[model samples]
Target: MSSDRLALITTDPAVLSGQAVIAGTRVPVSVVLDCLAAGMSPEEIVAEYLTLTSEGVQAAAVRGAAGP
Candidate 1:
């Protein structure tokens, strides 16, 4: 996927206190990263979070690694 696709991760002060989250959901990017850190695959993460997408997870990983 391209960085353009990774743009799905967004932040807004009115949303989750500005934490990076998937464009259309309240799910935090950090939570996804934590799941990955804890050995959850992108597939598993998506399965667990019905609202998330594989592309969103990939984007969140990229954005999380890029740091604040």
Candidate 2:
């Protein structure tokens, strides 16, 4: 993914106890991953979580695969 796309993932101590989340939103990155793991398509995820973008979801999947 491009650096700009990766930038869509962020973390803040005041948000979800600092868990990585989509930038500017409280939706945890893991939630996106879990939805994928549970057989939900990226489009489905975005439909369910209106605040998330396709790029953000892809970035979250990449970050989740990368490990801490």
Candidate 3:
């Protein structure tokens, strides 16, 4: 419900070489976007990646960052 998309994901040098990922998980933002781009639904993505949530996928699509 917030406009600040950055809050949905994080980037840390210790984590995936600072690649953007979901706030509390290692799932990369790019992965989520890739799923969507591949014609996968948010629900499907969430099912495939248990660490992901519908909200996170939405944020990833919007700000190129996965959900918390």
Model 2: weakest 10-residue lDDT segment is 1-10
Q: Give every collision pair in model 1.
A: none
Listed in order, each prediction's TM-score against the native is: 0.89, 0.89, 0.85
Candidate 1 local Cα displacement, residue 14, angstroms: 1.3
Go through the candidates in order and give each one's C-alpha lDDT. 0.90, 0.88, 0.83
- Higher-scoring candidate on TM-score, 1 or 3: 1
lDDT of 2 by residue, 13-36 (tens): 889999999997889998999999
Candidate 3 Cα deviation (angstroms), residue 52: 0.7
Q: How close is candidate 3 to the true structure, as a TM-score?
A: 0.85
Q: Cα deviation in Å at residue 24, candidate 3?
A: 0.8
Q: Model 2: residues >4 Å from true position, as ranges? A: none
If both were scored by lDDT, which would come out higher, candidate 2 or candidate 3? 2
User: RMSD per prediction, one decimal?
Assistant: 1.2, 1.2, 3.7
The candidate that achieves the highest lDDT relative to the unseen native structure = 1
| Model 1 local distance difference test score | 0.90
Q: Relative to the unseen true structure, what is the C-alpha lDDT of residue 33 in candidate 1, on a scale of 0 to 100?
A: 91
